[model samples]
Target: MKIAVIVQDGFEAFGLGVLTEVWNEPYHPEDDNPVFDFVVCTPRPGRVKGPAYDLFVDHGLEATEDADMVAVTAKRDIASPSPEVAEALRTASARGAQIFSSCSGAFILGEAGLLDGRECTTHWRYAERLQAAFPLAKVNPDVLYVDDGNILTGAGSAGGIDASLYLMRRLYGAKTAATAARRIVVPPRRDGGQQQFVRTPLGQTEADTLAPLLQWASERLDEQLSVERLAAEAHMSPRTFARRFRDETGTTPLQWLTSQRLALAEELLENSTLPVEQIATRVGFANAAAFRHHFAATRGSSPQAYRKTFSCCEEETAEQAV
Candidate 1:
């Protein structure tokens, strides 16, 4: 597919780099992947510089005219998007090309009037400004990204990675996205909202060691795990452990534990015939009432509701197999 990446002065280099690496990189020879042609476009054709040191691009805005998708990179300045650039985006969107943005790039889409009445996200730091500017748009600050079919927006820097990977999953499949994630050594999918990371400090020294503990906890969600017990397992005092855990991860221990338990409950709801009370016990909730409360709070629906909504398709597939 032909993809056009919009660029301009003072654009975030890493955001642009992530898109380029994912869509423009040569695929492994064994897979015979289709070529994804990426073109860098700017308002003016030649020698446009970015916010990063000594990085300049040499493509004009006209490059987007024929693209199948337009990916807008965030700019250091969000106050003014050139009329020409905005018009180009409008025209592309009108013609049915998929539009996407990372971080402040959502501002450009807003400028083009593409974000009106749509659910979207941007870097949390800028979400207020974006919402204030485009009063018609629904801004969700807690998500890693918002995928509204043809138009998508990511929350922040690393969220750009998540947004792009999700795009790959939608276009290709789970297997292709998994392959891409394996190459980068990041998880194929994250379990919770980016809010889990907000307001928490990361521990520098203990960061790498937490991955194993997280995996172990995920597998044993049925057991009661107090902060004291978890701290003991990590070989640290509770206060020190909490601080380090928050530092290493961007969330509190209880918040992380709740997220994992909910995830496990979701899986059981979709894949098994276990009663709500049994599933609640399996995931360490004291009773079905507690499970229902937490699950509804996190997932916006009760266990039976979630199962009723998600189980139909899976059952259909199973019946087809039979």
Candidate 2:
């Protein structure tokens, strides 16, 4: 595949680094994977300064002329997208190339009118600005990325990795993307709407008071875990523990606990042959009715339905083992 990554002055170094690392890294020859021909392109085809360093590009915007996919790296300056860069992007899109952007690169795509009337996402900090600037574009700040067929936009920073892995999944397959993610030490798939890092005043060490308590609670989900018990586990007053927990996790203790329980319930549903009532009991839910309600609320599906869909693969594997 011919992949062209567009770079420019003030472009984010980390976002571009993620792209280059994924596309440029040569796989082990014994693996028999197809080689991806990757090139860095600039508007002027010369020296371009990124956020952290300078790089010289051998190809100009013309490099995208024959490319199958064109990825725009994030820019530090989202307020203004250069006219030349906008035109190049529009031209690339017009040529039927799959267009993608990371972080604030959505602004460039918006300026080029490619993102008009399309669902997209940018950094949460810039979601309001992007929506105001491009009213026609549907800006979803909650998502890590949005793939609207030909044009894909990633939220921010690590979201670039998510978007790139999604592309890899589309071009290759889930196993291939998973392998690449293992090589790079990143999760293969983070659902698009997963929340980004929350802004908080507490530093890591100061805020991590409830880590052990959380781990303990996760292990004992089948047991009742109330505020008093959680506080005791953390060796703090209930009020203090609740306050500190919210500060560090950006969510209330109960909310976090509910999410963890839901996750555990999901795994149990997918991997076990136990009935809904049994799974509910194992995951600490009071009954099958309560588990069904919370599972639907958090996962957008009934417990039985989720199990039915996800368990198929496991069922196949079990049969193959037999």
Candidate 3:
């Protein structure tokens, strides 16, 4: 497949490097895999200046017209998307070609109207902005990437690498993607989602927020802790507690609790051999059916499938070298 990476002035060098590194290799006997045909294109097809350097590109947006995948590289200026670039992306999309954007490059896709009514994601920092700019699109700020059919959106450079490997796995096979990832020294997959990566605090007022309650709740996810119960625990009424919870966590009580439960479920699935039913009860999901429903809704995969991909031995092998 021909993969065209489109860039503009002040484009992110790391994003371009990631796409090139992942897709622009030749067949290697050691890896025993074939790579995609890759080319870098831009609006002007000349020297493209990045934040720290410049790169001369001989190809123009026309390179994307017939490419199987058009990767829009994030640029410093997402406010204005070139008409030629949008045309190239639309051309690719209209032909059923896969279109991808790394980080804020999703704004370019939004400008082209490709993200309308589709599930997508970007770095958590820009998720709100992306949604404000394109209200019709469903922006998921918590996932590392969203593979909504032909249009794919990745969070950051690391998420870009993960999504690229996932695409490789989808097109080729697990062994092929693993080989490619090994060649680059990255994990074959990162399935914990982007929730943990959101370390930025909401504001200075967070110091007075419900940190104690949240910590306590997180530790007891295996127990039934409803809003009323939590409200009494925090010495606030249910309505007041719910309001305060949203103000502090930027989500509702149920949403926050579900997210915490899902995080715990992920850990259990990755590091334990418990059956799905037992794991569900362990995570306070009421039953396996409810757990499966929420897990698939948020993580986009079944618990069993996630375990199959990320499960590992709980303890180090006795005979293995440390």
lDDT by candidate, in order shown: 0.81, 0.82, 0.83
Point out where model 1 deviates above 4 Å: 54-58, 204-215, 222-255, 258-322
Worst 10 residues of 3 by lDDT: 313-322
Runs of candidate 3 exceeding 4 Å displacement = 200-322
Better lDDT candidate (1, 2): 2
Question: Which regions of candidate 2 deviate over 4 angstroms?
Answer: 29-35, 66-68, 91-97, 166-174, 201-204, 221-229, 236-242, 254-322
Cα lDDT of model 3 by residue, 1-322, tens digit: 8999998998998999899888998888776788678899888888998999999999988899889999999999878757888888898999999999879999999999999999999888899999999999999988788898799899976789988987887777556777889999997766525352433355666535688898899889889998999999899999988877766665678888888788788767766677789989998999999999999997778987876665553233222325
Candidate that would win on lDDT: 3
lDDT of 2 by residue, 43-152 (tens): 88788886568888888888888888899988887886678878877887887888989889999899999888899999998999999999999999977888886998
Model 1 clashing residue pairs (backbone): 201-247, 202-247, 203-247, 203-248
Superposed on all Cα atoms, the candidates' RMSDs to the truth, in angstroms, are: 5.0, 4.4, 7.1
Q: Note the clash tally of each candidate.
A: 4, 0, 0
lDDT string for model 1 (244-279, tens) is: 788777778998898878867876776677778999
User: TM-scores of the models, in the given order?
Assistant: 0.73, 0.74, 0.66
Clashes of 2: 0
